[model samples]
Target chain A: MRSSVIIFPGSNCDRDMDVALKKFGFKNQMVWHNDQSIPKSDLIVLPGGFSYGDYLRCGSIASKSKIIKSVIDFANSGGLVLGICNGFQILTETGLLNGILQQNKFLNFICSNVYVKVKDKQNKYFKDLKKDLLELHIAHNEGNYFCSDDELKSLEDNSQIAVTYCGVDGTENEKTNPNGAIKNIAGIFNKNKNILGMMPHPERMIDKYLSGEDGSLFFKNILDNFK
Target chain B: MKIKVIVTLKNGVLDPQGKAIQQTLNGMNFGNVEDVRQGKYFEIEVKEKDEKKAKSLVDDMCKKLLANLVIEDYKIV
Candidate 1:
């Protein structure tokens, strides 16, 4: 599958996503944020990192990038988009996603391996991946996912809530959730269910037996979805 | 000609930065800290001399990129 990853000035995870896409057998290209056109691609991935030094707000400045307008158009045209970490914040800022990345309620930046509970396995991004426990690293200060009550209710009702933080036994606790994100959310899908934004760095854990390669399934899921 | 645009979060949207600023003011014993909502000041110097056209263009810029209509508002002065 063809994919493009957007690289903003301060995006540190662009290469990590490039490496992950290479593993997925995709002809991946890195698009600069200032470019007004998006490469013709099946999937667009917005990598993580402190875009524009996370200044003003995490994704505020990056969302105004010229390429982001095309990304928004791509989403409107039904193309798949995935935003990780700062990428997630950009999606919200651009109105592609339905929430904002508020300051972590704990008033601290969290950087560690976190355990996530998969809520859906039917989506293209989660195919071959069972609704099971996943260990991934999350690093960000503005990782808090905030939405209006009505929007959250709609997402929950539509089964768009994709991933949540929880213990190994399946119970969600505030402590293990790390950022005190509402409903322990680590990720979510857009209204069309094609776009996804998550805080955990799946690209950071793609090697099995080492990080158990849990992140590999995410790419595999996308590659095999072309059918 | 110069026009200033101030953009701020709309009511009910949480402004943590504004809250922090307000807290600092309260700590400083500023009795007149009625409210504090953080906003951006965009100092625009447009070559257009028509006041009507300048106001309209500035408003368009604010709508398109300066402010997020969903959760924020902007004023041109």
Candidate 2:
């Protein structure tokens, strides 16, 4: 599979995402944010980092970058687009995904491993996946997701909710919620499910020695789905 | 014209920074301190000569970029 990771001015995870995609047998290319067009690829990724120094708002400036139009066009056409952490913020800013990520409830940057429950597996991202619960790493200050009540209802009705924060034994409640996101939502999908935006970093967990192999399952699963 | 705009979190949206500031003020002996809600202000210098035109342009800016309508409201003053 071929993947393109867009690198904004302050994007720090583009290389890591490239490495992870390459490790999982994907031909990955790093695309600059100012570029007008992206190379042909099966997947497009907006990696995590404080884009434009998280200026006015997280991902707000980066969402208006030159290449974002192409990204939006790709997603509108049912192409696979994935945004992780700050990338997720950009997705919402671009209106490709629902809701906005607010500051953490305690106003602190949280960097730790979190368990996320797969909410819906009918999409291409998680279809036929072996595990229902996956341990992933989440690191961000504005990861608290919020949306209007009407929007939330539509998401729930359409199974647009992709994953949510949970406990090791699959218990989900206030105690397990790290950033006070609405409904402990860690990730969500567009109505078409072609676009996915989440606050977790799967690239950071691709290695078992350094982190864990659950991220491997994630990457390998996508490659499998692509095939 | 210099159009002044204020962007604030909509009612019912949690403002952690504002809450912290409120608590800090209370701890510093301001016992009657009420709730605090943080907001952003911007002064936009528009080339448009008409006041209404300038404000309308700024309103577009607020909707497009300044404030996220999902949780914030932008007011032109």
Could you say which candidate leads in lDDT?
2
lDDT of 1 at A146: 78
What is the per-residue lDDT of model 2 for residues B1-77, given as tens digits with 9 covering 90 to 100? 79999999999999999999999999999989999999999999999899988998998999999999999999999
Stretch of 10 with least lDDT, candidate 2 chain B: B52-61
Best by DockQ: 2
Q: Candidate 1 falls in which docking quality class?
A: acceptable
For candidate 1, the lDDT comes to 0.85
* Tens digits of per-residue lDDT for model 1, B1-77: 89999888888877777877888899999968977888888899888999889888889988766776656788886
Q: Against the native chain B, what TM-score does each candidate's chain B reach?
A: 0.88, 0.97
* Candidate 2 residue spans exceeding 4 A from truth: none
DockQ of predicted model 2 = 0.97
| Candidate 1 residue-wise lDDT, A1-227, digit = tens | 89999999999999999998998799999999988898899999999998999875678889888898899889999899999999999998887888788778666789988889988776778867754888888999988787878889988988888899988777897877788677999999987788999999989889876776778877786787775
